[model samples]
Target: MLMRTGVALAGFYFVAQGDWTRLLACFLAARAAVTRLTRPDEEKPHRLAEEVGREP
Candidate 1:
């Protein structure tokens, strides 16, 4: 969860900075989103809402 948050935050920061070197924003965003979407409900170790907290 912490990893996900950090990735998303950093991605947004890079996007706002308009730095192509950090175009990793696109990659991070896609990865986080794909993981969230593909994770099985029962496979999750914790409650969905609790683990992910809030979304941007």
Candidate 2:
């Protein structure tokens, strides 16, 4: 999430500087980041805590 945020912020810089090529590159990179960000986490840390909490 942080990485994607940083990449998006960088894109704004590229746009401000009129770097079209890099801006396009950032767009592609952001797409890839979004793919990962949207994917379900295979190693969710909360699962363990939830399982423990459920043990009344």
Candidate 3:
């Protein structure tokens, strides 16, 4: 959440200041932040199945 908010603030700041280079870097960081935000929790199904298998 922080990363996303920081990126958005930086984007507005950079655009307002007409700083193209930093804005491009912000865009790159945005890609990573969005990817992280969208990724699903990958461990839950495996853990659930293992626990079920172990119960009598």
Candidate 4:
């Protein structure tokens, strides 16, 4: 959560400096980090099973 907030703040800084490309990249990275953090832990077992070629 802290990392996501930092990334968002960096994005804002880029925006203030008119650095559109870096801002967009930072925003995308922050979104991906948040999405990863919020995902249900229940999915992990299924993912691990798939990785090991086993049924979940």
Candidate number with greatest TM-score: 4
Local distance difference test scores for all models: 0.73, 0.72, 0.72, 0.76
lDDT of 2 by residue, 1-56 (tens): 99998976876676747677776776788788878778786644466678788622
Model 1 lDDT, residue 11, Cα: 65
- Runs in model 1 deviating more than 4 A are 1-19, 44-56
Residue pairs in collision within model 4: none
Q: What TM-score, over all chains together, does every model reach?
A: 0.39, 0.42, 0.44, 0.55
What is the per-residue lDDT of model 3 for residues 1-56, given as tens digits with 9 covering 90 to 100? 99998977876676657677766776778798888778787723466568788622
Better of 1 and 4 by TM-score: 4
Per-residue lDDT for 1-56 in model 1, tens only?
99999987786677758766566666677789999889997766566567689532
Which structure is stronger by lDDT: 3 or 4? 4
lDDT per residue for candidate 4 within 1-56, as digits (tens), equals 99997976865776657677876776788689888888898754577787999977
Query: Root-mean-square deviation of each candidate, in angstroms?
Result: 12.1, 9.5, 8.3, 4.8
Model 4 bad stretches (over 4 Å):
1-17, 45-51
lDDT of 1 at 38: 97
- Going through the candidates in the order shown, the clash numbers are 0, 0, 0, 0
